[model samples]
Target: MSDIRDEMLRTLDRIVEANLTIAEREKADGNGPSAKLWAALTEQGMTALGETDSEIPFADAMALVARSGYHAVPVPLAETIMARRLLSRADIALPEGSITLAARAGGQANLVGVAYGGTAAHVVVADGDSLHLLQVTNAVVHNAYNQAGEPRDTIDLGKAKTIDRKPLAHATDVLIAEGALLRSVQLAGALSRTLEHCLTWVNDRVQFGKPIARFQAIQHAMAIMASEAAAARAAADMAVEASEKQADWFAVAVAKSRAGEAAGKTAAAAHAAFGAMGFTREHPLHYSTRRLWAWRDDFGSEVIWQSKIGQHMAAKGGENLWATLTEMN
Candidate 1:
C-alpha cells in the first residue's frame, strides 16, 4: 500500500498542518485539497489507500484515516476510501480524483451531507438498496464547512445528472455503519493527539518555578484523559477487526459509542490543561480538539449509536445478547 508519511504523529510535522487546515481553505466557493499535496499523495498512491474492494485491509486503511484525523488533514480521505470500496463492490467504474460517499435516505430528495462535499470531483450515493455514481459537475453544490474547517457540502441531487446507478442491497445502511466506524476511529485519533498536547503543556508550563504536571490535580486529570484516549483507540481497533467480515453495525455501535463518549472527555481534559492557550485561534491544539468535538457527533452521535445497541440487545433478550456480544470474537 502507498503510505502516508510515516504513519506516525510526526508525519504531518513534515507538512505544515496549519496551512493545510487554514479556515480560509474551508470556503463557500468550494475548497478542494491543496493541488500540490493532492498530487504528491496521488503519486504515492495514498489516494488508493482502500481502493480495489479495499484490497487494502481495513486495519491499514483505518490507520491512515486515524493519522489523517490526528493532524486534522482537511481532505475527504475516509470518504474517498469508502466511496471507492463501494463502487468496486458494485462493479462500477471508478472516477479519477477525490470521491466522497453520501447516503440518501429512503425518500430524501437531496444528498444531505458529506465532508468534502463540493471539493470532490465525484460522489457515490447509497440509498439502502443501490449505489449511484455521479460527477460533481453534473450537480449543484452549496459549499459549507464543519466546525473543524473541513468541507461539508450539500449536493443538490434533485438537479444532478447521474453517471451510473446500480442496486447494491443494504449498501446505504452499510455505508452508514462504516461511516460511523470511520468517524469513531478519527475521534480516537484526535483524542490521542489532544492528550499528547495536554501532556506537553502540563509538563512544560511552569508556575512557582515548577512544572504544573508536578501537581496532584494535574496528574489526576492527565491520567483520566490518557485512559479515555487509550480506550477509544482500543475500541477503534476492535471495530476494524470485527468488520473484517462486513460493515457490521454491531461492531460499529460499540466503537462509536466508546469513541464518542471519549471525544468529549478527552477534549475537555486537554483544554483544561492548556487553559486559555488551547482556545486561541493560532494554537494548533484547537485543530485536534475542534475536530474531536465535531466528529463525535458525525456518522452517529454517542446517544444514537448507544440507543441502537440498547435496542438491539433488548430485542435479542439476555441470553442472545451475551452471544451477540461475543459474536465478533
Candidate 2:
C-alpha cells in the first residue's frame, strides 16, 4: 500500500510540475487550466485514477490529491474523478478533457457535461434506479461564477437532444453520496495548500526586527491554522473511508460537515495571517484560499451537512453521538 501511494505521489508530482507551467501561462492569458494540460493528464490516466470499480485504496487516492492541491495545480480533480466513477458504473468510455459530472434529483439522476459541458464531446444523463442512460449533444450550458474565478458552467438537459437511453441498477443516493465524499477530498487538498502557504509566509515575513513567526500573536494564528488543517484532513479522510467502505450516510454527513467548516476557517486564518500580500494577484495564496471558499460550499455546505448530522443524531435518540463517531472510525 505504501509503495502504491508513493507511485501515486510521483505521478501527481509529474502532473503538477508540467501543469504548473501551463497554469502560469494561463494566468498570463487570463484563463485557467489549459486544454493541453487536460489532454496530458487524461493521456496519463489521471482522469481515470479512481473509477467506480477501482481496487486502489481510497486513502492512497485521497493522499495523492492532497499533495496535488499543495502545489496549487489547476486541474478538475474532483469533477474528473466523479466523471470516471459515473462512466465506469455505466460502462461508458470516459471522455477526454474538461468533463463535469453532476448528481441531482436526490441522486436518482446523474448528468455529465463535456468540454466544460457546453464544449464536451458527449453528455451522459443516467437514472441510477431505473438504469436509464440518456445521451445529450451540444449541451446547453450556463456560466456560473465561483470564488476561484475559474470557469464553471451548468448543463441544461431540457435543451439537450437525447441520443440513447439505458437502465442502471445502482441507487441514486450512492452517486450523490460518493460525489459528496469526493468533494471533501478535493477540499482537503486546498486546505492543506492554504496552511502551507500561511506557514511559509509567516516564516519569511519579518516583523519588529524578527520573523513574524516568532511573535506570540502570530504563533497563535499559526497554531490555529495547523489545528484547522488537521481537523480538515481528518474529516476528509473519514469521508473518503466511508465512501470506499460503503458506510452509512451519517458518516458522510459528519465528515463533510467537519471538513467544510474547518476548510473555510483555515483558509480565512491563512489569509488573515498573511495580511494584504496574501490577497494580491501576484501571490499564489489567493488561488488556494479562493478555491477553498468555493469548495467548502460544494457537495454540501457546512450548514447543510451539520443540519443533516444533527437531525440524524436527534433521530437516533441524541445519545452518545461522540461514541458513534469514535466507533465509526
The residue-by-residue lDDT of candidate 1 on 134-176, one tens digit each, is 8766465676767776777778887766889998889788878
Q: Write out the backbone clash pairs for model 2.
A: 107-172, 113-117, 114-117, 114-120, 115-120, 131-166, 131-167, 131-168, 133-166
Query: Which pairs of residues clash in candidate 1, taking residues 3 or more apart in a chain or in different chains?
Result: none
Q: Please, what is the whole-model Cα lDDT of each candidate in the order they appear?
A: 0.78, 0.65
| Candidate 1 TM-score, C-alpha based | 0.90
Q: Ten consecutive residues with minimal summed lDDT in candidate 1?
A: 21-30
Model 2, position 260, has a per-residue lDDT of: 84
By TM-score, how accurate is candidate 2?
A: 0.85
Worst 10 residues of 2 by lDDT: 107-116
